[model samples]
Target: MQAQTMQAQTMQHKRCMATVNKSRSMMRTYLSDEGVPLSYSRKRRIAMNLLKEYIREKYSSNEEIQEKLLETLSVYFNQVDNILQKTESPIEKTMAIELLNLIKSDSELGEIGFVDLEPQKTIKLNNRNKYYVADFLITWKPTVSVNGVERKLIVECDGHDFHEKTKEQVKKGKLRDRKLFLEGYTVFHFTGSEIYEDVSGCAIEVLEMIRSWHLSWVHG
Candidate 1:
């Protein structure tokens, strides 16, 4: 879809919009170079409110037209996630690419929703500057009703080179998991084998948990 709205906002940022379009056509998605996202609310976790707005408006009555919108978004995020792999453990690196492929390579997932996948992203403490680099940061869009929100989650991939771990490391892992939980993030841990065996199953498990949490938010 041609992101014609972006051109009117800032002339200097016009090139940012072009990245979303195909090489043949100069189209782009909602991400831009402003460096500051359009804010909405806490529940609406989407960084670019414009994208969500476009989705809602079009979904409202099926009358809005953003030609090739889905195709446009498909090309929105382009990055070399392997940049962080240099510092990651072998299993960590593997999980990173697998999860990225699981989302990007899935056409059905693309049609119903979009995801923001950032490797080595920092998650700050709820009220403190202290933060940790998450293995993978994921946020799924097109959130539906259920306490009126669809929360984000954290997936941690653990690797034991010799299938053994020190007690100290185990303690620290639990501490970090609890801290993430306290910060309102659903923390999940998968062994190298578990994720490698069937990343799709691992992903499906995560999605199911998110849905369960949404329902519990409203009913519990």
Candidate 2:
């Protein structure tokens, strides 16, 4: 996709128009850029009115009201993009790259590096065609044992799924985690808050788990 089109699609998927407008307003305040105080509630009401106008315009085939809503959305999203770009932190970028590289390496994890361990990395665990994306996957080449038998080192990653919808959804997530565990996979889970608050600590915990697995395989 063209860069602008891809960006638009990403924004559409990541945020609703209402959220865009609200965040844009908050960002403007943070930046102290020149802008009037925009009330989220009022803006939402205006959007509802616009929707009404849209229906009327559609029945009359006027298209003007529909064009207006599109224009408003475009401007709102642009503001949100600018605000986010300005406020974006380098730590998030660095951490993402660091975490990704840590996962890719074959070195034993320390208190610093963790890998995504979801079996989808070694086998198709999730029927999603896409492998399960996790924080770490630890695996060892099949090794010969003292009895001349072979073994496969296990891989597992820590997963944190925020924004689980309802109670049922949370229950389903637990079931899925249980199923993954039953399939000879180890699963570690954290919340987004934990990641943000104590990233280093979380990384350390993951590394310890991976190292333990490695040591057991070598000594077993």
Best by lDDT: 1
Please give the CA lDDT of all the candidate structures. Answer: 0.54, 0.44
**What's model 2's overall lDDT?**
0.44
Which number leads on TM-score?
Answer: 1
Which pairs clash in model 1?
A: 1-68, 21-27
Name the runs in model 1 displaced over 4 angstroms: 1-87, 143-150, 161-164, 210-220
In candidate 2, where is summed lDDT lowest over 10 consecutive residues? 149-158
Per-prediction TM-score to the true structure, in the order listed: 0.51, 0.38
lDDT of 2 by residue, 105-219 (tens): 3234433222342222334465456334333344433233235222222322223432356789679767766766666666666555565556545556655665665567567
Ten residues in sequence with the least summed lDDT for candidate 1:
24-33
TM-score of structure candidate 1: 0.51
**Residue 58 error, candidate 1, Å:** 35
